[model samples]
Target: MKKRGSGILCHITSLPSPFGIGDFGAGAYEFADFLSEAKQSYWQILPLNPTNKRYFDSPFSSLSSCAGNTALISPQLLAAEGLLTQMEVEDHPHFPERRVDYPAVSRFKRQLFQRAHIRFQKGGVPEDYARFCRGNSMWLEDHALFTAISDHLGNLPLAEWPQELSNRSSEKVQLLREELWDEVEREKFLQYLFFKQWHLLKNYCNGKGIRIIGEFPMFMNYDAVDIWANPELFKVDEQKKPYLLAGSPADAFSAEGQLFNCAVYDWDGLRRNGFNWWIRRFHYLFRQYDFVRIDHFQGLTSCWEVPVGEQNGLRGNWQKVPTQEFFNTMLQHYPLFPVIAEDLGTIGADVRETMARYAIPGMKVILFGFQKEARERSYLPHLHPLNSVAYTGTHDTDTVTGWYQGAGDEERLELYRYLGRRVENGVNWELIRLALMSVAHTAVIQMQDVLGAGEESRMNRPGKAEGNWEWRIPTADLGEVASRLSEMTACYGRAQD
Candidate 1:
């Protein structure tokens, strides 16, 4: 039997707030309240990790894959935690309320989190804090220590740091650990506040029956503390240079193909501990979210490995992956792990077979479904297949309204035939109707589409670099979007208790 639901796909950082970007504070609660009123069951977000300054192509490619983006750590919540006063937080550099100025927000939030760290140091650690440290010692210690060293020495790439630290010599590591104990403590404290605030927000959503859709990216970024800290796990040489980075061959989207230079894993290194690292990752995520969405599910089936010196993503080659055995071993240890497979882009039969074997549902995108070229676009709602998570559009695509207006006459006409109705008027609502009426058990729509927003509300453009993950929906849009979507939820039989 299928468990049906209607969900909102807005990353937590996109939640409306007075601060530069949304944080896991009141904005989270308000969003959850809105979702409950709208009868939505899932709250999907992008990978929650510290981002590099490039304002890079995606949140999927992020530093600190396991840690929450310190940028999203709510300053308002800090005030509530007594780390800052309301006025101090309000005085935060007058940031544009609508978009995230990453640099500006990073400086201001760092200072605020520093204050929280100071307070934690002065107050001394709590028992729960110690327990959290002990419980998460494996990743937490390395991440916290990496953050401290990175901050103190300036955020240089791990490769460029002093040889002792960069290569992580046992003697050097021990010496540095003793020398920089205080800094490590401070970083850990910052993470504690983030975890504290985030869990509180997650609990609120859970109380309202909203399960978070936390993301799990396929690989870790080079600048990440994790990659440097666990050098053996990736295909990196003794100098920390990548042995074989990952990317995809030329496809419909990019004629040159997709070059994902992120570090690929060394299965032998992982196999030694019986994939204990992977198990630990899922365990931490399972505690934070009810369901985990594995980004680039295809990577696990068969990865495309690019030589380190490749000029563009175009020259990568596809290599067979051992994901079948990996999943088999992983599930044997942790069974009831609910996951959603992102089977977008060029996928192969092995990918579907793997997902089907595990009973993990794949994703169906609605924006990709609609088009005037009847034979061209397969994203139209009428073509949706069951056993998948459906979306009006993903974080990468333009909102429904944007897709409609930007599409040519034939594209719109094709949509008309697909929906058996005029494509010209109320395109957003019509698409929503088709999504709800489909065989998909779970349907998700970006908050942008809920308000009939256009291109500017788009989350990320696949190849474009900047001005992504910046759009914010006005808080006032919450009530109307919730109610309007609730009506659709009821009509679609996805209304939750």
Candidate 2:
């Protein structure tokens, strides 16, 4: 992280695979090999948490902060472990090649997991599974039980469940635990497979000198296991419903501001407990990633809190938090904290001061540099600070080619003038070259940008809820892309060799 390097921003779900979605399978290994051949020092990915498809299927809005996504469990790996037969592995529906069919993938994987679980039950569980369960009992047990109960009750939110179950009173919890013990174990088995496969893939990448940059959202969804398991830690009413919601003030991206629909934290309660929960969370994430990117780092200094019933974030107020104390406590526990601050939105002096004091690298996006205002020059590569991570565009942004296509004539001309050229090469690669050659310590480009993809391959749209996080790369283009990226890495002195 201290050296000048570059990487690609591609989520695990974006990896090419024969299954409906990507997994910790051959696609993952092939990507690692491609990165190695390209001399890439890092492979940045979104959060690996299990996404709630019933929600928006956004990685940030996950069911559990600690649990891995079972959708990423490799069926081939399962066959290798003798839990699934070759025929079973080969017998799957024909999924779309360019996009993920989440619902279909969920159904297919769930049935396969059931078969694997039955086989494991008959053959006796492995000692490794027992050790993993014991080691992660702190969060795993509660998450497994919560998932089992949610399934049993037909996926109802905890608040809608029976009062005794919702409150998780000792007697009700014990009774349900006994009744749903098998279901809980089944959930645990799924997580065990996920981690087992993930570790193997991570080891493969690390062996190739590729470090993973994992994402961590600042706030938790109201329906997540974290809030459900620890209701006392959030701004909830007597009945455990949220009193205030998390969001941002009106910005260029949204006239009414973004309604995140996440629960605001009870800062006082968390401070009273010495922020041990966050400390544990960081411990888990650091073990899983070489560098953790704290999404919405500005929220740590202050947050925009809106009334729970508000239609939008226009009526929200900014409240300062105990940012310094929280970070200090976290550092006391884990001194060598390697983190990147996603300081993208409106930031105050205090936030900048905190990040500077901690020496944490902030972010610069080239897509934001073409604004009509001169004050926005910081996003330009020439103005980027040395201790920052630069990107052509983030997953939340349109692909470079897409942005160029959608831009007005004036904006396109301005972009060309800024680059001191007029479409000499593809806009995507031109922007990528700018990022790689910048003074920032690290540069990352989205996979779509590297492939010169257009709007059809866009990963997300900020205001839109559906039709996002579905983009996937085609397997046939990896070789050519790797060769081009390797040349670029060497030209910019970012090559590892």
Candidate 3:
């Protein structure tokens, strides 16, 4: 954001809700009200794409980049819309409050969704639903068909499916569409409900003068509809299997590097097609969000290409992309690109140059500021550039308190010296204060940090596949921090007037 402002980094699923997991319901509205009370100007969230159990429900590994997660559909909203009865909405089994029970929640929500679909059909499909399908048919139709076929084939991977279906022969696809008309329609109906609810919440936030910041995932899942429908755009083999994957090369963090297991984009193929696929993706995202954060922004300059069958990213080579030409095309399509770059690890000069050329704000995390050496402490609040977006920590890092507790003695001493005070407790607030007071135009605090929560509340732990992306906040804790946050915001000249 160009304007000086502050916001909270809390995902929609992390909001307090009675329906096992959060959705676009009363809880979401209440959160927006809390932001207003806190004098915040923005609300940053993770990707809204659909997550899969196979991927440990991480938002980054989604079923479809274009489709909304059906599990996030609110039964409460359904009742209000006459799609279900109040009793039906409240019929869910008791779910844990502090963490999401994905399986339990999915089963419960799926049942309600089925009933709601039946009701929707009985009431006759509205023109709005038909119009939504028509508007998003570019991706919606293929996604729905892919999902229906996946379920019909007992969740078999597309590569293992019969040659006719995997290749998506026109004759086979037509027959499958006719045979599975009901299932296909059901999938489309779910998506219609998702957008209708999502936009309503977004409008409510906008009315309160708060803008939404959404993440644009860098890679696409191999099993996703986009890859299946447009195989030529990715590095897949003759049988439509991924031969090269996306990941990071071995660096200071890991000796073995990291294997992302996602499909790598063939930049040449994209360039040949005039980047039409990317243009469509950008158009869809801007329509849904006020600002889109380009995740893994370094990949735009060059990506570490890991060959398939490799256990890790050690042997991957850096493949360069036509960064200048790509952005030129994007600018021609959308003159005003409101984007933030996730320029975190090992950012090269080329990446920095591209970001500067586009005037895209890069990120700075306060948690990463406490280094043993002063030269390495560029993330410190005092060093943050005015164009940057500063944070206490991101979803990938531990909560503020957790980081403080786990940091080494030398780092803690450096932090104390930096502040000219040895703070024993409320370290999270100390960092929050520093972030807000920084020269950075925008500052964002994680909900966990705002609550002074510890390691147990950390959102995601990279490298650990399971038990991540399950943290949820208690309903009682939301309003408690507004007064404190408001005073700090006003003191730092970042409050919304």
Candidate 4:
């Protein structure tokens, strides 16, 4: 991060695989090799938390912040370990190669994992599994029990469960643990496999001089094991229901603002406890990633606090938190924590000042640079600072090709004026070049932009409820994309080696 470098923003789910969704299998290794071939110094991925398709499939809203997506556990790796048969690995439904069918993938993988778990249990638990459980017990025990109970109760949110269960009464917990002990062990076993496979993949990338940049959401989901196990740390009443929810104030992206059904943090409680939970979170994440991108960093300074029953974020009020003290406590414990601030959207002076004081890098997106007015130039490549990470477009925005195609005449003209080129040469490549050539120390290009994908390939639309986080890359395109990206890297002096 000290030197100028480049990376690709592609979530593991977007990788091509025989299984419906990508995993820490051959596809992940191939992508690491691809990054090495492209001379890329980093590989950025969204959060790897287990997704809840029933609520929202967004990785930001996860079941457990410390848990890895067991859906991402590679069956190939399991087969290699002799836990699964080769026939089981090869035999699969004809899944869509271009996009992930999350539900279909989950159903298929769940059955396979169950078989593997059965085999592991019958044979014997490995020493590594025992060690992993002991090491991560702080959160693992609660998460495993929570997951087992949730599954046993048909996946109901903790708050909606029986009062004894929702409140985590020790007597009820012990009773359920005894009844669901096998399922609890199964959950723990899955986590062990996930981390084991992830470390192997991460080590492979590091060996090739490619570092991983992992994303972390600012807020935890209400239904997540974190809040379920530690209700007192959130804005929840005695019944564990949220009194104040989390969301953003109305902005250009959404006139009604965005309604994120997460519970607002009990800032006072966190401060009184010296932010131990967050410290432990970062401690775990730092071990897994070289650098972390803090999502919605503006919330650290101040956040829009929407009431519990609000339908939209338009009626939310601003609530200030002890941002400086929180970070100070974090730094006191882990001073060298490398972080990238996702400082997009409505930024206040306090947010910018805090980031500057800490020397943390902020994000700059090239897609937002072009405006009819010349005054809006901060996002323009030439105006971008070397301390920031520039991007062609983020996972939340449309692909460069898609944006250009959908842009109005005025926007197109403005883009042309900024880049000093017409769209005929391929707007995606043009913007990719702009990002690489920027003074920003790091540049990240979405996998979709590298392939010149259109609107259909967009990863997310901020306010949309469905049909998001499903984009996948074609396996055949990796080699060519790597070559082109390597050329750009060399030309722009962003090459790793």
Candidate 5:
């Protein structure tokens, strides 16, 4: 593992915002400045992709891995780019000022991106658009067509579509391509605009020495273009319904384990093709960011396979994975890229062994450390692997302040004992300091923990489907925390050493 540096785990949506969701505009520039001031090297975000109604609420549940979330786009940037005028963005519509009301934000932002797309289409293409489209053709064409068709599907399942269309028959697809060519072309142009703006934003962060850490979920949404296009990779029946699905076992979030209905990959088929699907996904993602964190990292070793139509993972069984082959293939192709193993919750020894063999760093969440076994046990920082990444808490876990507020006396005492101190006023900060001081190579503090905020700042609560991922931060500056964190990073030698 490389000598890790300090970073912050702030989902892009939680950055300073009044726009319901954060975007790669002024707020992003501001964050880059903060990261530079804080001497932090990384800004970790959840997946950046297009999503559906239920899942757009949680970035973890996105529709397409390749398509950028049209929602996170900044209208202000569109204006600055000559695609829109201030007259439009300022007076377009009134949106919620506090947490992200995604639906409303989506509607407003879509119209803006649409207008921007129109302007770009009518006008000649920019140099960046030419570069991005040329570079991303590996997935962009298919993804753009998928977006166009999905919207045309109008919430109808693929099975119900006309047979030719449903099967993606060559003749019908060719016809649809010709008929919907304008829409498809415009959609492709929209993605091009998104990538162009996103690249500019990324360059600003990189210039400030801020590297982004991004997450890639193992399974994608059923309505995604990937599944609709290549149902062969999944355990889907002829009708394209999933035979078996993905999820985790029962835990604090739910007595019934989560039943993520997305189909599990066909390991044999994946191997036959040399996991080309995964290769493209990783290749495209690496081109966009500094590091990729595989969510549910244990799934690569062994996944909890839930039977389709099952309400929960209660009856799911542990299924073996072609772990060695899957990872060995990726490592062969992209040996230089870094991957963080999100090894949390009921991990098996094989998972740890796999991570060690591959030199991939796993995670240690401090909030989970509140448990009896986590402290004075191997899960604690003292016993953690030097190649691991330590977090005060994660997006799904409660914020440290929220944890302290909700945990019982025994739990608090456990934390106190571990830290060798009585609980104090700023318990969250204390935990952050501990994480910074831990032996793990990388230390990441969540935005909520930095604010010492309570449950309200919590990004998601796992099992609770809706009302998660909607917690957007106010347009508050992070200057104070940035200065304080810089001092702490310097003190801990976590500054880019």
Candidate 6:
């Protein structure tokens, strides 16, 4: 990140695929090749953590932070590895080309996964599979048990389960584990497949000089395995329900406030435990990716804690944590903490100080630069600091063209004035150019913006519940701008070799 470089922000789910959702398959390698051709140095993606349909499959709200979304396991890759037959891989529904049908995809993949598991069982487990299970046992065993029990009980929440299992009584758990041995092993097998395919793709990207930048969400879903397995690490009540939820305090965004319904961390308990959970989580993430973006970075210093059952975010209070001690411990574990801070929202001075002290790069989304209150000069291209990562917009924001289309006259005039010229090359390209030319050492653009895609191509809408995270790129459109992007990258001194 020290040298001038540029990357694209496209999640795995957004990549083109015939499996209804992107995965670690041929399309991923093709995207890597495209990135290399376009002179990109980084391939940033959202959290690959396991997602559940209950939360509309949001990546941020995951079943296990240490686990990968099995839905991303490519059937094609499985067939190539001889686990799935070629005919079985090709036999599928007519999936939507531009959007993911999560439920449909889930149903389809579950069958394929079962078949693969059965085939593997018939052939006997390989040494590598055994090694993967053993190496990831810390989280793998508990997660598998949690998943197996949930399935056995018809997807009931942990709190609603029988007391013996819910409380994780060692005797009852061991008994249940024996009973659900097949189910537990199936879950572990799925993880093995997800990791095997993922590392292969990561290696391909690295071999092409493209570094993978993954994300780590600050909070965990209340129903996640982490909360159920490690109750002491969270602020859960007697019923195992979260006493406080994670969210933002009432401000300009909402008068009442927001409730994320996510579990809040027990900061004191974490510190007492030497932040072992967090250190392990980082170790898990760093092993797969070159860099990791710490989402909701301000939470490291202080978080807005809203009491559970609150109708709105009004009752939330800022709770501070041992920021210095936490990072100190993290540094002790990792001598080089390669992280990008998602300092997008209302961040405090303490958070900023910690980021600066640790030399962690913060984000500079150009979309926010034109907003009324956020028209800070630092957000402008000419004023971006060298230590920040510049972007046309993030996954949560609209595409560059979408924002430009909806911009008020005043905002448009302001943007034009900042550019000091007319909009000749499309607005998306103009912003992309701005990002590339900015003093920021790293510039990351959304794939949507690269094709001048509009609102329909936006990856996500923050407050809206559904119809988001469904956008996908077409294979043909990927190479359309390679030459132009490569030219601009070289012109801006961002091209590698």
RMSD of 5: 1.9
* lDDT per residue as tens, model 4, 221-319: 888888878887899876677878788877655667887878888999888888998999998899999999999898888888899888888888888
Instruction: Assess the local accuracy of residue 410 in candidate 1 as a C-alpha lDDT between 0 and 100.
Output: 72
Per-residue accuracy of model 5 over 1-497 as CA lDDT, tens digit each: 36768888887776665566788778878887888889998888888887677554567665776888767777887788788989888875666665777788777777777777778778987786778788878777777776677677775755555667657555877777787787788778777766777878888888887888988777876666777678787677666677788898976556787876566777787788789988988987897788999988878888888887788788888988899888888889998758898887768999989987878888888677685434425556786678889888888888888878877889888888888989769998898888888899898999788888898878887777778777666666678887888898889888864
Q: 17-74 in candidate 3: lDDT tens per residue? A: 9988988999999999999999999999999998878778889985687999888888
**Which residue pairs come into collision in candidate 2?**
none
Candidate 1 stretches with Cα past 4 Å from truth are 55-57, 371-378
lDDT over C-alpha atoms for residue 203 of model 6: 93
What is the TM-score of each predicted model, taking all chains together?
0.95, 0.97, 0.98, 0.98, 0.95, 0.97
Number of backbone-clashing residue pairs for each candidate, in the order shown: 12, 0, 0, 0, 0, 0
Error of 3 at 31 (Å): 0.5
lDDT of 4 at 69: 88
| Candidate 1: tens digits of C-alpha lDDT, residues 1-497 | 16888788888778888778888878888888999999989899888776777445357776775677767778877788787878878886677866777778777877776677777678766898998788777777888778777877777776677777777556887778888998888777777767877898889898998889889778877767767878888888776777687776765445666656478878778778688878888888888788889988888888878887876677777777778788998888778768889887778999989987888888777766543322334455555667788787788777889888889877777777776667566788877777777778889888888888888788887666678878887657567767788998988888897
Per-residue lDDT of 230 in model 3: 89
> What is the per-residue lDDT of model 2 for residues 202-292, given as tens digits with 9 covering 90 to 100?
8999999999999977888787788877888888865567889889877656667777868888999889878977888988898899999
lDDT of 2: 0.86
- Candidate with better lDDT, 3 vs 4: 3
Locate the minimum summed-lDDT window of 10 residues in model 6: 249-258
After aligning candidate 4 to the native by TM-score, how far in Å is the CA of 489 from where it should be?
A: 0.7
Reference-based TM-score, model 3: 0.98
How far residue 444's Cα lies from its native spot in candidate 5, in Å, is 0.4
User: What's the lDDT of the predicted structure labeled candidate 4?
Assistant: 0.88
| Candidate 3 global lDDT | 0.88
